[model samples]
Target: MDTTVANTGTEGKTWGGGNQPLKSSYGKMMMWFFIVSDALTFSGFLAAYGFSRFKFIGSWPIADEVFTHVPFFHGNYPMIYVAFMTFVLIMSSVTMVLAVDAGHHMKKTKVTWYMFLTIIGGLIFVGSQAWEWGTFIKGEYGAVQTNGGNILQFGKYETVDGNAVFKRVAVSDIAIDAHGERVEHERKNGLWFVDESALPAYTVDEVYNGLKANSDVLVRTQIINDEGEKTVLSREESLNQIKNNGKLVVQGANLQVNEYGTSLFADFFFFITGFHGFHVFSGVVINIIIFFNVILGTYERRGSYEMVEKVGLYWHFVDLVWVFVFTFFYLV
Candidate 1:
C-alpha cells in the first residue's frame, strides 16, 4: 500500500499534474459536493410538495383540466399543450447526455455540436414554458357569482327513469366586483371618454352583498364536473332575493377569469410553474457560457477540461428535478 501511494505521487509529479487533486481538480470536487447538497435540497422540496399534494388530495384540482389550452386552438383543448412541454424538456435532457458522452471521448468537434443542440433544446423548452405561463396568467372560463369569488363545480345526474341524461348548474353564478359599473359608466350628460366596455361590470360593494346572501353556492380556483356539462349558473335569483328588485352587479380580475380558467387558480399555477421555468432559463444561460469555452480551446490549452464535466453534472441535476415535477404537476 505504501509503495502504491509513493508510485502515485511520483507519477503525478512527473506529469506536472499537481492541479489534479486526488485524481480530480478543486473545481470538479467542489461541484460534486454542491450537487450532492443541492440534490438533497431538491429532494426536500419535492417531499414537501408531495406532502401538500397528499394533504389536499381530495380537493386538489386536476392539472390537465386546469391547463388544457393548445397553441392555436380555442379553450376546449385540455392539457395537451403542457404535455408537449414535458416532452420538449425530456428531449433536451437526452441532447445534454449526448453532449456529455462526446466530452467523455474527448471528441471536441462532436462535443461542440452536441452542446449547441442541447442549448437550443433548453432554449426551446424555456420558450414553451413562457407561453404556458402566459396562458395561465390570462385565464380561461369566467366563474359564476356576482362577487367573482369561489369556484362552482358541477356533477352529472341521471333521471330516475335511467334513460334520460342531463346536466344541472354546477354552482351558483354570482360575479363579484365584476369589471365596469352596474349603473352605466357614462358621463352625467351622456358623453364618455372611455368606452362602456372599459368600465367595470360590477362594483366591490355589490359583490360583497351578493356573497352574503347565497348559502348553497361555493367558490374555488378551478371548477370541474364529475360527469355532466358544468354550466355557469347565474346569480340572478340570489340577487333578486337579496334586494327584491335590485339588479345584479358584476366585473375584471374579480373572482372570474377569462381564458386560462379560474383567476385564483391562474395565480397559484403561474407562481409555481414560473419559478421552475426560471431555473431552466438560468441553466441554459450557464450551458451557453460553457459551450463557448469548449469552442475556444480554453480547456485544451490547460491540459484538462474538467469544467465541462462539472457543468454537465449541473445540467443533469436540472433534468432530474424536472422529472419529479413533470410527474406530480402533470401526469399525477
Candidate 2:
C-alpha cells in the first residue's frame, strides 16, 4: 500500500504556520506573551493584597489619611499628589500612543517629540512616587505601639459643620523628651554581634506625661467603629493606655512598625508599590533607548516603526496596571 499527502487550501493563511501568525510579528507576539505573564503576576499581587486587606480591614490604614501630602504645599490635601501622579502617567500613555501613530505615518520628528514627552512624564511620575514613599516612611503624626502590637494615634475631636471630626495630632507636638543620656545600642556596646535599632525620639514615660499635660489630646485606636471612624478613647482611657500598655513610640513606617496602623499595611505598601515602580522605571529606560534609535533613523531605514509599537505595548500595559493599582490601593 502507498500513502500520499495532499495540500489543503489553508496554506500560507493565518493558521497555516506563517511567519506572522494572526497578523502579529514574532517580536509583537513575544511582547504580548510577556505582558500577559506580567499581568498575571500583578493580578496575583493585587489579589493577595485584597485578601490581606479584607483580613485586616478594621485596622487597615485609611488611604486618604496616609497619602495626604502635596509637594511644596502644607495642608491636609488628601489624594491630591497621588491624583497628579496618576494623571501624569496616563498622559504619558497618550503620548506613547501618539508616538506609535507618528511612527506608523513615518513622521520621525513627531515620533521623537512624543517619545520625549512620554519620557518626561515617566520621570515625573517616578520622582513623585519617590517623594510619596519618603513622606510615608517619614510619617507625619506618630503613634504609640501597645504591648499587644496595636497602634494608638493621638488626636482631638473638633466640630466642623456641626459634626465632630477627629484631627491628627503629631507626637512631636505633644511628646516632651525627659529622659537623659539615652543612646543607641551598638554591637560593641552590648552583644558582640548584635545591635539595637535607633532610639525613639520620646520614651513612653515622656509621652504619658505630655498627654497628661494636654487636656484636649485623646488616644485614637486603629479599630474602626460603627461610624466608620477610628475609635477614639476618652481622656481617662487614653492616659491609662499610655501609662500601662504603651510599649514604644513609633514615629514612622518601616519593615517592623507603622505609625499609620498595622505593620502589614506598610509591608504591602512598600512591596506592591515598589514592584510597580520598578516596572515604570524599566519602561522609562527602554523608551529612552527606543527614542534615541528613532532619532538615529533606525526605523525609518527599515520602513517600519514596529519597534516603537512594541515598546508602546509594554508602556501601555504599565499604565493600565497602574490604573488598577490606584483604584485598589487608593480609591477602594
What is the clash count for each candidate, in the order shown?
Answer: 37, 0
Q: Which 10-residue window in model 1 sums to the lowest lDDT?
A: 1-10
Model 2 ranges off by over 4 Å: 1-18, 188-192
lDDT of 2: 0.89
TM agreement with the true structure for every prediction? 0.64, 0.92
Per residue, candidate 1 scores C-alpha lDDT tens digits across 87-168 of 7777877777777766656678887887788788788888888777666654443333323333333223457677744332
What would the per-residue lDDT of candidate 2 be over residues 7-84, giving only the tens digit for each residue? 223335655533453466656777999999999999999999999999998878888889988999899999888889
Per-residue error at 27 for model 2, in Å? 1.0
Q: Which stretches of candidate 1 lie over 4 Å from their true place?
A: 1-25, 144-149, 153-268
Compared to the true structure, candidate 1 yields what TM-score?
0.64
